[model samples]
Target: MNGPNDWFQQNQDRYRREQYERQQAYLRQPQRPTGPPVRQRRAGRRGPSPLVVFVFSAVGLLVGEAVNWFKDVGPVFSSVCTVVAGLIPLLLDYWKSVAEEPAPGRGRAGAPSYDRGGTAAGRVLGVLVFIVVAGAAAYGISWGVGYVTGNETVRAERLVSPVAGRADSMTITVEGVGVTDHYTKVRISAVSRAPTAVDVGVGHDCQLVDDGGQTLQPSTVANDQTLLVPANGVTVRAVITFTGRPAPTATTLTLDFSWFLAHDFGFGAHSLQVHEIKLKADPA
Candidate 1:
């Protein structure tokens, strides 16, 4: 029979061989990755390109100008219009993207990639468009809110109309009568039927006489320009400003155009005047 030590040694060798084989088999098998699962990065939203920005800016400018052309409407209207236009590209892009269906067979666990405007060029173009649209929109909103509204530049209602008179061969139509913080303004259009242009002197004896016997002297005549009525049925517009505000309680006012008529050297009366210009019931 073999010795006990020899038998023990043989058993140990077999055990070691079995352990090595098991380790080799484990190494050959596919590995289950350790730590967190590697995730596919999502495509980011790109900004608008320079070309798109330029186009958008140009469009905004054109729209803004168009809106500004209406004199009755102020910059507020123009700015609002421009801003609204600027948002068009973005809105279209958003709607178009939203309207599209997701790529067929794509799932949440997959690459998660999809068409970005359909191609690489499209992506770039989309970026450009977005930039332009966004920039224009920002400018319009800022200008309207920051500059226009902050300044409170809305024009006040001032002009009163439908008052007229005639002296000699010159017909004077009062276009408007308006009051300001400092003075009252009277706008008139004078037409001369004479053969030559009539040189009307406006300063001397020109005044506004209120019902309360308050008289305000003429401060300036048509921004200090000479009042000349063109001949042969042509009309000349002039603005006459008086020094003081009329009395609030005064219901009726008179405008004396004596000096203007007298200096014309025509066939009309020198004392031409509008006896009564009815004031508004409520005064500001």
Candidate 2:
């Protein structure tokens, strides 16, 4: 009963209405964001906190300074201080082991609680101990190597001995010369030709002079100080120590006994004298 044209117009009206309805429904719905997707940061293992590191470093520095201050006291004292410092953290860790009690109807009472703070502190202390031990071991090895090397070098070179020189009525004979990287030791015997006992003092007046004119003072004296030389030729042995190895060019050593003679022996400046000894591979 309907014509073809009418049928086509009805189909077109239905299609338009459906499209309008779909657009309206879409418009009523919430709008979706069109920006880039957000990303979440992944969790990872963390290192020691700044405060913990800072505290550990501060403690280490304090301990190091304390050890250095004890060096002048003696090596034994310094070593003891270092050992005690290393043990302090371990002792504190032991004390930090605290027992916690649970509530009356809860889990086992008097059980030990996990202390995160204490664990962290223990780890830091362990790291500090390792560093200290490694440093000490390295220092000892270096010292040993230096000592061995110094001895080898010293033994290869020849030095003059039995060299004698006189100042005023006192005569000094060089008995030995021992050289090393850490120190240089000279042994000498002194005797006086004076009719009476002569008082002689060894101090700054004693020095070692190199061929380059560089002079080094005695760091220590063994069995050597102010001495009384008997009237006869009775010899007194004195060992003089100078810190560190002397220059290879040290072919001569000059000793000034003027001050000691003037102060102790009542010798005038005009009567005072300086003694020079030649150091060589062969006797002169």
Candidate 3:
């Protein structure tokens, strides 16, 4: 029997009270995180923790250095270390193998959307840092190998005169001496007063004599064919190579036997002499 206006007023007050109670209950509940994992805003994919990425990269670099230190000791052990270093990047995605349940009813609808803004930027930065550190570590390790082994090569080049030696009546002249990484090459010309051109012998019998008389021969050596003495003596050119550098002062050359014997015996073991000429020291 109440008027319609009175009933409407009572109903409005009841609705307001109910809404206030519901809000109060919601506030009482504990706060919870609903956002994606840190550093990853890939809407559907989980990203690696930044801290973990940094630690993994640092460990990788250290492992790489260790590998270089022990590489010469055991190839097998070094191989293992290299493998470990190369696996660092794989750690970032270690958890990726576990399949993620897609949003219900969202599967097959389309590719999940990603927050490409800040999330993508952070991931890019992380990868860049990893690469830079890795490259620096590799370069440092290579340098360390050279330092630890003490096998650096020597390089030098200079014009030199005939040091010394002779093959009976034959004459040999040194035109240039070049010393490069791990080897030395000597250019020379040879001629014999004989009426016909004679062979220019080379091989085991040929050696380099320093001022100290250290007779060292190349583990291997070769000549451009052979030097011949034409009637006019065309001053044929020849080359000699050795595995290492000679003393600052190399003073003699020795090639043995008649030039003709060279034709009969390939790289024969014989001795001859080409005495010193305008030999001079490398400029200080």
Q: How far is each candidate from the true structure, as Cα RMSD in Å?
A: 10.7, 14.9, 12.6
lDDT scores of the candidates, listed in order = 0.61, 0.54, 0.52
Total backbone clashes of candidate 3, pairs 3 or more residues apart or in separate chains: 14
* Model 2 accuracy (lDDT, Cα): 0.54
Over 81-112, each residue of candidate 3 has an lDDT whose tens digit, in order, gives 44355446444364352334344566443344
Predicted candidate 1 versus true structure: per-residue lDDT over 1-284, tens digit per residue? 99999999999999999999999999999876554434333255333444664466567656755554333244455455554555566566656655553555544443334443456587568656655565555455545532322221222324344567777676777666667544666767888778777666667556788889999877643235357777789988877767666777777778876554334454543555776677764356
Show where candidate 3 strays beyond 4 Å.
1-154, 158-169, 195-197, 221-232, 248-271, 277-284
lDDT of 2 by residue, 1-284 (tens): 99999999999999999999999999999866454333222233133444554455345444544554333222333334444544555445445432232334464343333333435677678757755764464345334433432321233223454677766677877777767446566767788766666766565555666667776666643324555567667788866665555566566666555443433445543223234556654221
Residue 41's C-alpha lDDT in candidate 3? 47
Report the alpha-carbon TM-score of model 1 versus the true structure. Answer: 0.43
User: Considering lDDT, where higher is better, how would the candidates rank from best to worst?
Assistant: 1, 2, 3
- For model 1, give the 10-residue run with minimal summed lDDT: 148-157
* Model 2 per-residue lDDT at 47: 32
Winning model by lDDT: 1
